[model samples]
Target: MASESSVWNTCNYSRDVTFFYNLVGKKISEEWSTQDFVVIGLGLTVCLIVVLANLMVMAAILMNRRFHFPIYYLLGNMAAADLFAGIAYVNLMLNTGPWTRMLTKEQWYIRGALIDISLTASVANLLAVAVERHQTIITMQLHSNMTKRRVVLLIVCIWVTAIIMGLVPSTFWNCECDLDDCSTVAPLYSRRFLIFWAVLNLLTFFIMVAMYARIFIYVRYQSRATSEHTSEIRHNQTVVNLMKTISMVLGAFVICWTPGLMTLLLDGLLGKASHANSFEKYCLVIAECNSLVNPIIYSLRDNEMRRTFKWILCCLCRKGADQRRQPSVKINSPLSEETLDFVQKSEDRALRKPQDSHDKDGWTEPRV
Candidate 1:
């Protein structure tokens, strides 16, 4: 349907090798402009931040014995998922960056598969965290037999499901958008697959919402029983904190994933899923930003995590300050306001409940 001259600079090569043509029936080279470099530079910076933040999360969990419980284990797994997703973004940026060339069909398949696995794993971890909280906190289960081995097995199952969900469709599904009959427009089958993926993510989001709603119902009942006694008052405050944490987790998930999900839905349904547009790319960039926010949401309000983060930051800052020959500056003093606040809060909470407070970030309290 296009003009004969628009077939491309290397039509034979594009067909045999790339098999990817633009909507106007031509192949676009990987040449990038100043704006492209700026865009990619910003993306790379986010990727670096995501990796480091999640790594700090993982390190904090590993170094703290109080975090060895099932909930923190699940959270650590979520951080690991984010870490891998960040790495995948780095790889993708390389494949699609200024120095890039046309990718063969196999490269496309692999890239899509990796992205799916990373995202699906993250979703699965969130679901698992929700379910775990529902079981232990709201239901008031006195004991859990969920050992580390069993937890590892459960995480393995999650990854296996993610792999199947991600790779199976790409390998077996029929779609002109990714096949020899391809043009810029996405075929019917391809559109269906995109819709299906979006619906699955939506379903998971609904499940998490339902679980958190049940938790709130339980917390509300506890609120009624809370008396003027100090411990009871602390419990009531804990409930409020739990509610806030749930809100943050849910809010962050929706904000980051919604753009990417909606874009896929609209693009596939409108039959333009195959063409690489800036809108789609930017939507995905927003989705990647989700990884950057999780560590903040997961660690910021958590007293212990906040302290650990502060410690690390001060250590790094102190080193920097010492290099500048500032001898009188004391950033490492435990008597500082930040340290005193952390210790006071820790002691206050420890008086009421002592064992595991990491779940404060995830909304888990012993009493229902």
Candidate 2:
């Protein structure tokens, strides 16, 4: 009976080995075609667009002193996150190589770590922005007290936390899984890793959703109370912009994260199957693409960003044109009559005597 059991176990092992090898061999035998090239081109295009868009956002915020406020700082952080994530995705797609070349185990591990860090950073930054917006809108008193130092501290903390989260797989677990053509060795979902990620993602998502919802409510109420047309229009525009920002963040979060979360939950509850492997990979790729979509959405939806980008481009073009036309043009200064009149008015105002506040208060000697 023991011999028969050994034979059965050996047969199962052999079958598993055979199946894995077959899958790898089939993938190795496959050739890259025009369809594959198209896919690669599309992915590259997305990466390029995302990188450029995010860089433009960062540049606009950095170059414009008017945009140095806390809100733009938050936006800058988000753009930074998107830029990193997009670059990481591009690296992954490019490293996969054409046709028959498979990624090395080391490359897979590195890419996995990078993806984890980038995605985690992107999510955390979004949450931070939502929280900042909430405090400014709902808790007006607190917003006045919030300093740039505090915001910088918060951003630092976010990156630290994200880095720690990403490093866990590399530090504690064996992230060496051999797939057919692609391989990933992420840290096994041990209790510690599972608890950490689950808590992190859930807490961040919940807080952002709640904060954005409150902001939306407050903005709506304020908009209804205002009677001036221009004021109302401005307020309405602000509310719309805030709503759009929050919606885009939430939409990307859901699209990128929901599939992975569902897959993890399903795997825990109902074990894994061979067919689910491809589905999981597809979901992961889709989720990673979320980082690329964010900047595109911002550029498309936000007028301020759009205008700033246009302005920057226009300035560059004008500068180039001026450089080419430099020798032909000579500057001559002429004072205008309006400028002289303005100077005279300024001088007249300066010559006038200042009124004392006490004189206007009408305190007379009889009162004393």
Q: How many residue pairs clash in each candidate?
A: 0, 2
lDDT of 2 at 357: 38
lDDT per residue for candidate 1 within 1-368, as digits (tens), equals 46655644323333422334443244445678787778778888999999999998887777555456676777788888889889988878877753333666556666667778888998898898788777766644322447999889889988898889767644666353344333232221255677778788988888888888887788677757656567665655664564566467667877888778776666555554444344667778788988888788767557666656666677579787766565565543223566555665655563335455643322223222
Give the lDDT of residue 182 in candidate 1.
Answer: 35
**lDDT accuracy of residue 150 in candidate 2:** 82
TM-score of each: 0.76, 0.68
Q: Ten residues in a row with the worst lDDT in model 1?
A: 180-189
